[model samples]
Target: MIARLARQLGKEERDLQVLEAVLEHQPIGITRIARETDIDEHKARYSLRMLENDGLIEPTPDGAVATDDVEERVREINDGLDDLIDQMESLKDLDG
Candidate 1:
């Protein structure tokens, strides 16, 4: 179960990297994002689609930009992941 969750989240992590790239370089194109982030153009496009579907980013003629909602949601998700890490650390004793 944990392995499955990790696999799922690994994809999300990549997507987040793409989102970060877009946010950092607002109004940039897909090809440029791929070059900047060292991701394949196809993978970058997939990430963009996911971000768009989730309302985290919007398309501009030049490229893409993070939505206002993205910053807030990114904060929330970061906090939640921090909490998850703490919980996982707590489990170490149980395993021992």
Candidate 2:
């Protein structure tokens, strides 16, 4: 379960990297995002698609851009991650 969680965290980190790239460089393409994030094109594309499906981003003729609600969503995600960290810390206490 820990390994699965780690994998999930890694994927989320990658997705966040892609999102950051798009947020920083609006009207950005997959190629540029992949280059900037140091992720492969396929991963970048998948992340973009996931973001779009989540309503955090949209596709434009020029490229991809973040949605107005992106900041709010990011805040919520951060808060959730913080909660997860607390829970994980509690779990670590089990080893004691």
- Which candidate leads the pack in TM-score? 2
Clashes of each: 0, 0
lDDT of 2 by residue, 5-87 (tens): 88988888888999999999999999999889999999999999988998889999999999998999999989998999899
By how many angstroms RMSD does model 1 differ from the true structure?
Answer: 2.2
TM-score, model 1 to reference: 0.79
Q: What is candidate 2's TM-score against the reference? A: 0.92
lDDT of each: 0.88, 0.92
In the predicted model 1, the residue pairs found to clash are: none
**Stretches of candidate 1 exceeding 4 Å from the true structure:** 1-6, 90-96
For model 2, which pairs clash? Answer: none
Instruction: Point out where model 2 deviates above 4 Å.
Output: none
